[model samples]
Target: MLKESTELSMILVQNRQQQLNGNKRLFAWALVLLLFLGACSPKTRVLKSPDHRGGNVGGTIPKEEKPEGVDKEKTVEDARRAEAARNSVALILPFQLDKISPRTLLKEDVNRSAIALDFYQGFQLGLDELAQEGRSFSLNVVDSRDSEVRNQYVAKSEEISNAALIVGPVFPKEITSFGTHLSNKNVLQVNPLAATRAREFNLPNLVSLTPSIDVHTKAMAERVARDYKTGDVVIIYNTSDNDGRQFLNGFLSELRKVNSSAQVRSVSSVPQLNEEISLTGTNLIVAGTTDRFQLRSFVSNLEAKSSQEYYVFRVYGHPLWERIDFSIYERFGDFRPIITAESHLKTWTREAKEFKENYYSLYGVSPSDHSYKGYDAARYFGNLLAKYGDNYPEHITKEKFEGLFSAYMFDYNESWGFVNKAVSFKSYQGSSFQLN
Candidate 1:
């Protein structure tokens, strides 16, 4: 079991790096952290902290650019006219309708349905919230789990073809395939989940709801450069794998943009990592390994080497650390680990509290992080569609959006279509995460 888990971890790391490099497809399973969500019991919990603001506010504002061939005056005028008419937003999800029947279904089938239903529930809430703001739009949900023939039928269907905004078609192949059919359309095609840079496809209207790898890595690098003195930072990475090398190189590139002389080190194993012993100065360690075995060994070695000191041995680690047994490594007060996040769930806020309560009331179970993500994505785009009409993509990067669970700041990359650049950092403080 441990070997299987570690193997999966390595694959995930490789997949993430491939997506970042535009060499391979993004890890589609990332949209649903199935194991994590399924293992936890459904229970409502609130985070009570002496300091209400847990983490550092993380957001990036991209410089606005004029949408090519778009006449601004005419677009706004058309938007105003659209406000009086009905707009449609289509959601394509993997509901696997054909598999669900009178026969006993497999465990995977049930789980997929649960995830889709949760996202739908949250999306409906977002629509309701938008409706309250005097914005009206027709909701169209399409199941992407059907046969490729049906999907092709959906691509040409009026429900999708006429949508002011189209969300989901979760898998990369599905998204890119749908995009191929809608290539000439002016409608917005939203990759509502995952961090995939579907660059291989020639999709002009494509945009992702989640931030990309470049955004997260560059943001984390910028944060480190801003917070700490250049001389005190050191990035330690594994040199054995392509993913490790990619992360190490990308992080160094971003760090160099801020501090040209920032130091870096590469180690393939614990034996190679034995050379470091500095403890007097405030040390910042940026770990680049995403493999479970490597991380476990690295943390164990670092933890064993630590001693009491006024300044802690601060580690800026990978997000996969949260999925593994990271709590055991946080035993010493002198050692701290920080992980970057696309969203930080604020349980104390009124909006969050109400959403959770309402979700629980409706489903009889506590919502997972994906639910919050779904709601935020729906609300953010819905608001823009209401104001900007079919040309919402033109003004999407114009304003900063502070969502209940995330902050939306978009930048249109010619090579990778539109990307969200907002990123948040969080540290495990006792039972919940605090902004770092």
Candidate 2:
């Protein structure tokens, strides 16, 4: 069995170094190539399709057209008919293929190009599974480098123009550039990456798989409203940061809708926190700032209060609390620390275990969060396209899909298109993370 949090925690720890060095993109590339190379005996090998028909092997797939009025057997004819009507899913990602050479693969290139390969591999697995269910997919894979010219070229292609669903173009700017061309069309664009919701690609058909900061806070507020009825909630915010203020505003809006009597407090020190915590029923403390110093202070003070507290104090903190020394926060007794996550993998599940086994067999290593994300994205969109045909968006919310590492429960926004409202609530229990 996969060690649930340890593996994920280690990956996060390793990712931080890459993130700080401005090389996290490269880190993902490195991990992907490491897995890919492990599958092969020799350094250089051409990746090919099982069937005779050609596919994009770290390159573009040439567009194939069906012959007009072609004669065929009944089975072949039915297959052809299904193929012609299959949903076109255009996957636009930054492969950076020109930087990579199978003959002379460098350590740095692997680091830089791993994300595209990893996502592609997992997506392929998902598509393969869908094929078993008689689902036809017209996949148009394009490499959109971090250049406007590349994005522009791909956006103008017939494959993309005629596509029913667009999977990526990972970065926010590229999404905007590609979406700008297809704004008038009813193409359902999926932003599989990026946490920030870009203003440029706020079209009705664009769906963001990664929920925004505001979305995270809103979900937390809703959960608090529904669950903590006995508590008198207090939102402690910092006055300096505009983003923090924005989060505070959203939290207050949601809090008012449910618990209209909840109080908002702007406190910076231990003395002020003590003053706020003196009188309460069951106190629901919300740390509204993302500042590390502020977080540390609040956490330390809260820990100090555990000895003398009469009423129950359950903490609901910002997601940035993950970056802090959790060893200290974990020391606090009965502190139900709640935070929102974009995606949370339940590795204990049979589906997850199966996916891990398949992945390890193929790559010689356990799968990471990115690998699971790719699988989920492909499974979700491919299944939807097969079931609903070209009009899949019309029936998006009809079914709810629980994937290996993610959940799909989308709510359509007129300005920002389809935003995934699903977020995982994790509580720090027994010095470990557990889904609540």
Candidate 3:
């Protein structure tokens, strides 16, 4: 099942050499490797031991060869001591290796495994950096297969039981299922990707890295409240969909908290919203729908109406608006829409440039959002483990990190565990979106 150390330099070097042929070939090679890796059975792949030296090793931990006169008890004791001293971290991801078949493998299959592969590569790079800085860790990578039964089984494994920190099981349902089976309440399980609210899971030891939708709503609402004026009217364009309504409700609740008497109205159509807008005062338009079609239609129609009448307005959009290409719509720029982003990597910055260079050098490809997230997660939590040992969770709230993609400032919730409150608000300025 490819139980191996994080010493992936040899493999990377070989891949990089092949990549020099052409960019197209390089990507093809990467996909091929991903498919190959995904064909393996789910098993625990252990990183190299702190004491290990010389060549890279793979497969299951070999049986220790004892000398004829060596005392078995003493050897066992020493092994236990070494294990106890070294920090153990486990990463549980849905590689879904079983889904890949030799005869039926397609580009779609490779794409399915890409998220796990990208994250793993970035995570390995982070660990490599830690190792270079003289931090020792025993990393265990296990495939969750995105199965509830599999998660339950893996949760009870020795690797999970011994781990000081567990990094994944990416989806919300998987996180809940895995957490349910985990017996060790002290071990911190990180929800690396999911944007689901922490309170829903009710996992006391869970650390949610992604800020929830409610956080985005509150952040946007607070910004609106801060800049609010007496004559300015706040109008919400909401849909009947639960997601749209959730943002609408959350924003209203937070806005009311700051300005109890704020002039606010909710409308379902562009025409109704246009009627509420005044030419004299600034109209704060909150687009509460995450649906791309509705957003496009609403924005286009409102922009046309506003431009024709010369109405003063600014738009606040749902978090999902980050996915939409507003630049494509010629009228969107005029609205000067502001939206919440979970993470924003300034690629022009020195740190980002170096990260991209290093990532490309090693993986022979550009880093994706998952890759950045993985690197940050590994580096941040690995540092915490090195500094705080088993008591890392206690210090999580106190430790703040600004990584390549995301900035983390956790607030400890007694019921929901550590929830990252960090969120970025970006505004459409000139040709592109910039941090507000």
Candidate 4:
């Protein structure tokens, strides 16, 4: 009887094991179905049809035969009208939905998905606003999957090929790869997030929304040059990596351009930096490092040294410093640190307040920086597309926009495409950074 009981227990354990395996398989299938549905849902709004043309729905005008010797200007105008009638925009982002798993999922995966979702939602809201304003658009959202192979495939797809405006494929590598594939196309591809220099990509049809590090350096340098006095000392503390050194070089170049006679000292060590700080005239110190740890140590040391000697100084920091939390350093405020900011959202403004309320009501959460970025890109580019049609690229530099997060003033480069040169300076004061 005891032997029989043991055999019965083993059988029951085997049955339970099989049941668990079956449940896992069910869960995996369910997750995949949910992801597929999510992709086709209103959030993505992917237009589908049984027709061979893939249901373009953008109201593209059919080409009509024209007799020889038709006026060229009239032909062009007709083409523009046709283009205006066809308003299709494609947004390609790294959703990486294919990597989702029931097991072995990581936090980074969730974060990436969240970023994509937030940006998509914000972009949709912007387009929704335009729709209400009578600007019709057929937006096709594509997932790049953050893979080069996937990006290349998407870039060559019919939807992307026909888009009036294409925004994203987010990261620098993906942008370059995708843009390279579409080099022959006349479509303007906006680099939505990467702050990498425009010249690096050399894509003539690219529009970079994020201000490059060089732009930040130049802005800070100009500000420093403007504030320079005869008695004031200019110093650079540069214990940075190659990327950071590029910023330092750019800053120095711009500073020299404005004030060729300006005497600036460069120091690497803490003791050397301390020796240059003066108690008399204002000491303008540039913290030329992108390293957050180094920045914290440097700021802490400066604060300690300043307190000990009552040094009167102004600290000009790298753009990356904007992301570092200096609130922990009690004396960081005393230095009056200034950093170049690309996005300055005035939350107190009526427009900003309304946007926040509307966004919260729609998404049940506050908008992230990416959300603001996506909204501005959609609104700015959508308006341009609606206004100028196929020739919107010609008018890109002519238009200036002030959105919730950023002010856009584009300068066209023959080699590097369009660069957003608008940058704002923020000074740390009264426990918070404010526009200066």
Residue 288 lDDT (model 1): 64
Can you write out model 4's per-residue Cα lDDT over 145-201, one digit (the tens) per residue?
A: 788887787888876767888899899999988988884458889999899999999
Candidate 4's C-alpha runs over 4 A off are 1-85, 101-109, 290-293, 308-310
| Cα-based lDDT at residue 80, candidate 1 | 35
Candidate 1 Cα errors over 4 Å, as ranges: 1-85, 103-107, 146-149, 200-202, 239-246, 276-280, 308-312, 330-333, 431-433
Candidate 1's error at 413, in angstroms?
1.7
Off by over 4 Å in 3: 1-9, 18-85, 102-104
In model 1, which range of ten residues has the least summed lDDT? 40-49
Q: After superposition, how far is residue 52 of candidate 2 from its true place, in Å?
A: 19
Tens-place lDDT per residue, model 3, 167-210, is 99998889999998899977889999999999999999999999
Task: Give the higher-lDDT candidate: 1 or 3.
Answer: 3
What is candidate 1's local distance difference test score?
0.63
Residue 181 error for model 4, in Å? 1.1
Each prediction's RMSD over C-alphas, in Å, is 16.2, 9.3, 5.9, 13.1
Query: Which candidate leads the pack in lDDT?
Result: 3
Q: What TM-score does candidate 1 reach?
A: 0.75
> All models: lDDT?
0.63, 0.66, 0.77, 0.75
Scored by lDDT, model 2 comes in at 0.66
Residue pair clashes in candidate 3: none
In candidate 2, which residue pairs get closer than 3 Å at backbone N, Cα or C atoms, i.e. clash? 26-111, 29-110, 29-114, 30-110, 30-111
Which pairs of residues collide in candidate 4? none
